[model samples]
Target: MRRLHTRTARRRVVGALTAGLLCTFGPAAPALAAPAPTVAAPAAADVAPTVDDGLALTPPMGFNNWNSTHCRAEFNEDMVKGIADIFVEKGLKDAGYQYVNLDDCWALQSRDANGKLVPDPVRFPNGIKAVADYVHSRGLKLGIYTSAGTKTCNEAGFPGALGHEYSDAQQFADWGVDYLKYDNCNNQGVDARLRYTTMRDALLAATGTTGRPIVYSLCEWGQNKPWEWASDVGHLWRTTGDISDNWGSMLSILKQNLPLAQYAGPGHWNDPDMLEVGNGGMTDTEYRSHFSMWSIMAAPLLIGSDLRDASDATFDILGNKEVIAVDQDPLGKQGTVLSSEGGRWVVAKEMKDGSRTVALFNETGSAQRVATTARAAGLPAAGAYTVRDLWQHKSYNTAGTISATVPAHGTVLVRVSTDAKWAKNPPAVELGLDGGLLVEAGKPVKLTSTVTDLGRTAAAQVSVKLSGPAGWAVKATSPAGTHTLPTGRSLRTTWQVTAPKGTPADSYDLTLKASYRSPTGVRAENVLPLTASVVVAPPAGVSSLGDLPWLSTTNGWGPVERNTSNGENEAGDGNPMTVNGVVYAKGLGVHADSSVEYYTGKACETVTAQVGVDDEEGDDGSVAFEIWADGTKMAASGVLSNAQAAQAISADVRGAQTVRLVVTDGGDGSTSDHGDWADAQLTC
Candidate 1:
């Protein structure tokens, strides 16, 4: 059965120019002292341009076609023209959307005679340059798609960037491609950084000859934290699995991108894939929440819905200026969940202006009043502030604390700013298990503490204190904060603890005390509670008799099946046979008679046998057994009497210490039944 690899919608944004080049460019205005563009030059050294360079250029915002087109790969001139016209007509370019991208399946199976990559004749009869020209005419940039692996999503079977990175890159550049979405499929086990770098270098090489800046979009599916390394290679790297139209899939994908806030900035970002905003899987409220969250995450605002006939609601979601501002904010700090209560989640992002943006989301199935507080977000004491609802376009001067009723599977985003005297100290210490709370005895447990510096950088010192029953002992302790815990950095320590021999299965608590020097040089204390548990030991051994390791010999006889055949056959005539042995009243008893069928010159003959037991290790004797057929005992002492005709055998004995079965050939040594034993059994 074929299974689909779930794709995450996010893409990694590589270096500044590399990053900017990957995004859609609105009509270029006069240069505003922008950083020198670090065009990727195809040098033989194989060195990568820094991520700083990629993020310094275009900061990635555009429209993608997948969510709108779905699996329909017939991207004809009319389709391209229609979408490009809408982008210009809707004023989306002025709203910060510039790239009109075509997703997978647009390529023909083979390249042209000129050795240039070929677009499908049926889909692009007028050629890619025509499409590029039209999109450019609309003052918008054009992006194309390809696979890093050997096949495109369309399965049209085009040559991938596997070994021909340079050629493929040149081909795209020669086609006047402004953006390249290099997908990861069919390319298994390739080093992510190297895989992406190869393409980035190729694009640079291609762009060098073409003298046009083509944005490199790395779509490795965030196998590695491309955000951390993608800035050096491409414009955007997907951060999660591909998104479905369903809200569950969308919210789940959004939640996964929360921890990656530190890596986003101008020109580089965590792509949550494309938008499914206009899809019918969710309500308008949910889409608004979706748009709001993506904007706050600094994710690439790639609208995946059809733009030509978007509903008013779709346009409203795409045109939410306040939310868009937060996304395009120069500071580019991604928002993260600060706290959660039931289905209500509170997320926050710190802006460059020293203000904070908070989003209260209700992911549950019903509406919920999400309460917000300064403490939950690691802010200073709560008091007075100015708050604006980004989606509602309304402002209110309220206290430091805020509360709002969020619709089901929806979110309310607010920007908070204040001129009040805020505390410069780190928030109350929060502790976490570096690995996990559960641990095996004698194994080391790593603990971590998050120390936040409200505004000013503060130094934090953390120490763990253990208190348990009399038998419990503290194995070792690392110095307090000897491991530097920078502001917003976590301090970690490994504690080695051993359980006492008689330790019972119970829970034990450990208190972690964290003290810190505030920016004002004042010392304060915060305490965290942690727990650990002990488990029961394994049963005493019966000498190698533990859990049944193999499935074949464990319980009752397994059914004879094609996969595990155990039947007597021509190929396996002399193989050993196994039977369920029964022990009764300290003696061996043959529950059923044993018999073997053998072919003697095309004539079948039946055989019978007798068995006995002998006990040597116990007061009761063991068993010695044997089988006989055609007036001949199979064997008395470790030998088979009938070497040729032997069909089956059985054995029964009592008070015996040990039992041994011997095989004896019959007088007639016929080759047809020369060696065969169908089945055997022993019972006591």
Candidate 2:
């Protein structure tokens, strides 16, 4: 399953721009700093006819074993059957998931005497047809994988369908295969379209003989701009490379796929690879965003995690029916960018019932308010509209505003419509802070929160309460309870909030909860979180960053460690911070797609660190280290691998409010990508 895990350099295409998609879906967000990918359009006469077998009316949702098991011994007939059983027992089948697809390494390295592909006897003792029969018995379809080249992507080098497409296709049809994931690997330098189209024609012929139509999926990694010509060739074509279980990989793939919304429809789709939820490489918040954005883009939603040991949180994300509805909408229209600025993105998708699914995405490192209007979301002008928060499972009425305070790498998905049934739902109340709170330990700060009724109906028994951590005192300065709040009216409450003495200088969450009831007496509650900083100014002279408190820290796989290497995806699980055989006494160890921010207080003059891929991962890790001072990139270590020695980097932080250290995957999947900032220090 090398094609499913390995990532190569992105091919820069120089061809015709999708002007129609840009005009219809809006332009790419400048804040992402990614240019739209271009492709050359072929002449009408030469374009291959797309598959029209009436399959994949919606982007296929299923489970693939490659991401979790790869080529491990666990990927056998029992594993496949167990997953199908989970689909039926755990509500996945009822959630609209159908196909149970297997990736590479499912076949023997050598074919049989008849030149037909053979399932690995040890992995599938019952043979391919028996396993397919078991899956079909569960009322689910089964899919198989192979390469268009001479050999598959696995290290075993299984035989591919390059010259034996008809024979392999006939074999798969005979085995009752319902889907095929055709990969690009070891192709012997053949043209991409020709190889994929040949298989498409072979599958058609085999289907014509057996009357079993198999869904065709092309995994070419977007080298040839498949979207421009593969519409009639395959049911779905990958628009980018494989996705890693990290934020940077997910975000990068999203940016690449976001610009190609116009090419997606009922029968054809733009595949951005499989889902990476519950892989322990990211937080639950990030996973939700990953799921939401994929659904919004109308990409295939293949579960990449092993379901046998999935956590409840993972199941909650994968089992959200409302979010799945957006992906399966009969309209088959993909979501497009409405606006993107400063790491805040607003994407909207038109549904079949005159509704729009809007996703407020925050790509920044901190929580921020992201907002858009109904008109901007492509909703018709109305005096009042309904906004349903898909994740929160709450409905609110809005005059037109669709906004939320989204966490870092988080998404707030909502459906906006003029449906009248939403009026019976709870009144939409939102909590907002008047200004930023920066307080000292043991000092009381006056924090004000404004509660607004955005719903169509008035709210009764509206009470606002402010809560904080233990040892912190909270006293209301204004009336905490309001008898009634009319529509469009707001109630402001000031709170005397204090942090406990000896509190560390870090970001803390202060919540403002508003409890109210609709005119019909339905109880409703809204909780808004505010991130306040407890500052302890650094002393004069140079200080080690490990000794100082950081404003915030996020890591790809594990908790950012001080004076250690990121040993595993857990807190307090790390070795001494070592880079290229050098042990560091103090610094930060993190994984790729990780960031650590310090409150410089506009006092630090310079920040320095010795950065590289940690030696714990041997010579396999690849990463890029960057230093940002107040949103300005001051220094960068371009693509440092574990094979290289550590490089010293310094960034001028004079007069900057915050200093952020970032490490990203170096054009590869973030497997074993352990990054270290050795001897990190700040000078004031």
Candidate 3:
């Protein structure tokens, strides 16, 4: 049993994903997919893979014992009851702290002769059933932890339920457990799917008509790629190992889970372990960052600290309504990191109310200037926005951009309200360029920019101006052809860009300008002053097919599907379907049991590719491949049994404009499902 409760005593943390993931499915896809799907929002990748319990409409907010009690986590009913007292007394319950979870070490040294887990008699003389009743009296829920493995962490001389799923679950239901935090320790190498499912089924069966269903939390330390399928089994699944009370540990887990946002929905959340606020190891600013990040991600805010003696800063952070509001936003969309620099990061979240939140973080030795525009933070282009600095408790207004100087390890979290009322009449006509641009010097490569009218007023005479390297020619036309936009609608246009033959093998930025006149007579001008990188051949075509914008993916935040992805896959987080950052035609490793579609834009005669399962994670999982052209199945690869080598991929995409690739868990779920779509491309 790996006793994670002793986190403070642990030397190092496990499961920190360093490189970040790109959100679009497949590798190199951008988060902002071709605007509008050009027709409707692209179908979201497979619905959540968890069971439908209708619980966790938003991630739970609560308190857990492990981080605070450590080895003392054993069946100490009084301690739990005391925390329950604090919950009501300290305004936590009113602030939304409900569950009082008893993490590992709560069970007795051994099960009774009938094979039911027993609370330690000495520590819990009143019994767990009584404790549950007491917690209920406080208007709070009760939770307990057990392992799927042979023994729970901190063994404590108890035998795990290894083979006793039904009995234990029935026993807990009878004891009135409102939630179950099932850990993974000493499982004797049993397949995680069976063990977790066994318990899930047991819990379902054990519930009597009057019994409320338990909120199941799977704590396998993210090793089995649970995000791809955890929805059906548990309310929330831990995406990484334990969270320690330190900056690095907290940030590591945060970065790792960012890319898996799309996998979470109502009742299903991506767990990043527990929050370590007020744990005495990190500064208050760091704690705020930890809290804010978790909230923005819509993660369960299970604080693992001594609530009985929490300090003022702790109370201030724990009770911040604005920050918590963002987490509980009805939209339920998890925030993603928009951009990151040396020690600066900008994170953004789109809310249900149509407002957006942007968090600027500085992780350096001193204070630093961090800035971002509404568009860059993933917000719709707005002429002005109402900004509320959450931590500073100040509200202000800004035009387009929000900039601030933040202290080391600190964050400036602001909520920006960009209602249509705030829309700049000429709303710089939202524009974006797509596809991997790797054209040979003398050849002309095509480009497309998605233009949308973000304002309430219709606009006309919209024009897009593009400038390439000197002597280079770039041509662009509006998607609507007439260079106009109907309010709330979008148009996608094409561009033919060519570079001079003498341009050496280097990269240059293609500068663009978008302008339009609002019906109100205001020249709404927006400059995509952003430079588009146009790579000059050679290394750019490492693959036969052009890749999506590296930032796109199944989850936003750009998962570490490629070596270029900002984050790496930490072992304990899950098996890497795509591994070692190998540059596949798509992202790094295909996410286990997940699929991403690429818009071909242009029709192709046929598509052929070299594909393989990820070799880095060994050959434990398998993937089934299928290709669809313009919504028709073109080819299928019966489950590729080995992830260590290449599999030839071919699809009859003749004259089709969109090609989609789907990889499944070869029947056994996603164990070892690392995959790669190498050299994927269209024969234009």
Candidate 4:
């Protein structure tokens, strides 16, 4: 959450005056308030509805006009109709998608003379109601966009439900809107929860009066936990910021929603905003991964692209019935990361059929073999399993456990069932680390192992043993198999080792052995070696100030400054200045001004400085100093004006040891013409 702060109007007046007086004023301005916090309404009453109620409708799937459509020249009725027709013609509707959502930038600037909200006359000449009717005629739902704040992002944007919640809600209902995607922008200084609830209450009131069940879609961008409260006020809340048409953005949004699974149900769900699955910026493999992740997350399947002309690959991905089933599972238990190793990630979802759906996801740039055993997914015990590849629609009967080679940024989803019998086969165990081969000693290391039975019916017994040097000991363990071993069958363990008094510093190898019985009652063993070590070193000193590396120049507006070959120069103009080794400034201008220069052979671990300024004209003249690390500001001095000179301002640089300084000109239009600083210093 971002903090709230007050901006002084005087600074703007001064800057304007200075700009007018000297046509040479540069592009330097004080940092403004951070972006506002986004919040959603309170949770809905915890009453579970029947499967027949609207609440039980299949997680509303549809194409959203945000990622791709936002870049268009306009969002008019033709565009909506074209997208809707494509939804049906492309077999998307058959795949269970029923909505065509229009995101921001579709509204007029004001209300009609009759106090009705109006659509842009030029783009949406027939108004939103006509658009909704057209979409309805195509057997799909229509969603409109609005902001929870004062204005929408489009031109002719009307002040939405902010302050006039009831009026706005009534207008939306009258407009025959089926879905209302309430956004958050321009509504600064308002409590997030209150901001969302204000609109929710108004919408609910209007819904009741108008005899409509407008599916309220909260779009606060997850400033707070909307999954916890959206069900009470809206159907779904975006769990992340608006997604872009790129794999990185999609993956980031998906990863952020993994922790909110427990909040999803039949009607209510976690929304990773919308889908960029078909966007051109991502590869085909990435698109598949996107679909798989979204399905497992129980996120609303809202596609944000030009579906009217999608590629065949897009259709195949979106139409994967087996994968979609996991998303629409009646149990509604969202999947979470069980383990991640060597670019291989294992995620599991509990199904209503007393089984589990596991996905082996390979996020690496290259394809990798990913395997999982029943124990890793919290199954009853190791046993031969009937596994079906959801994507390939293939069934394989052989197994000690389930495993597959996943494609780069791809996933292999399988439904594991024990009740159904299979031919007898030997049990097997595979071991690996979650993060990497290298790990810090004494910390808990998560080991992922899969135990599987060749014959799906027989239970497999499993045990594990750890062997290392005499001084090393296993601290704790979590067993995943049915029977705990003298060592343990768990995937995680902590190790502690103490070297002898005169022992030489070195690395040691430890062997982990896992043994298990196959469904056929056959015994098998697997061994894996892990390495650990300790290094001894002496303390070091900050030889010289030039040895500290500052912030990188790439971070244009960041606090730290880069150093030149021999030593960077430091000035006290638009940039910051370091006095006594301390960097200080009011606002460090990115361009010329007051600045500091330092050379760092290598980046320092930390830097410290004292900053402050004297007030020459009492309350009129104030000074400020700021510390920057690699162009990023680490700290700044509070405005200090009308004080004595030699006042101290301070800041600590944590990561980047070397930095520059910024001094700003502050104070009333009187005594002090600029700010000053003293006693600056950088420490290790």
Instruction: List per-prediction Cα lDDT, in the order shown.
Output: 0.54, 0.81, 0.65, 0.57
Best by TM-score: 2
RMSD in angstroms, all models? 23.9, 8.3, 16.3, 14.3
Model 2 bad stretches (over 4 Å): 1-48, 434-446, 502-510, 529-540, 543-594, 601-603, 608-657, 662-681
Clashes of each: 90, 2, 44, 75
Candidate 4 local lDDT, residue 252: 49
Better of 1 and 3 by lDDT: 3
> Per-residue lDDT for 33-87 in model 2, tens only?
2321112223434333558768999999999998888889999999999999999
lDDT score at residue 364, model 3, on the 0-100 scale? 46
Query: Once model 4 is optimally superposed onto the true structure by TM-score, how far is the C-alpha of residue 368 displaced, in angstroms?
Result: 3.3
Error of 4 at 576 (Å): 18
Local accuracy of candidate 3 as per-residue lDDT tens digits, 299-335: 9999888887799899899989889998888788898
lDDT tens digits, residue span 268-361, model 1? 7788778888877677877988898898888888888887768988988898878888888787778877777665888888877877888988
Q: State residue 643's C-alpha deviation in candidate 1, in Å.
A: 45
Point out where model 3 deviates above 4 Å: 1-50, 73-75, 208-210, 419-684
Residue pair clashes in candidate 2: 49-232, 50-232
Q: Put down candidate 4 lDDT per residue, 1-684, tens digits, no spaces.
A: 000011122233224221111101112222335423332432454222211236534466887776666625556788888988887887778778877877765766666786556666777888887888888898988877777655553323344556667777777777677777787654544666777777767677666668655777777667666777667666777776545455444554666788887887777777777777777767776788888888887777888777766789988998888888888888778887887765588888888887788888886533366877776776676435666668767454434466654544677777876744544433323444332222234433344433333333333567556566776554325554564222213344433334444444455666666576655566655555555443322124443332333222211112222221101113221334432234544222221123453423233444443343322112334545566664467777655544443454445555542356655434321112233333234444
**TM-score, one value per model:** 0.55, 0.81, 0.57, 0.57
| Best-to-worst lDDT order | 2, 3, 4, 1
User: Counting only residues 3 or more apart in sequence or on different chains, how many pairs clash (N, Cα, C under 3 Å) in candidate 1?
Assistant: 90
**Model 1 vs. true fold: TM:** 0.55
Residue 307, model 3: Cα distance from true site in angstroms: 0.9
Minimal lDDT window, size 10, model 2 = 19-28
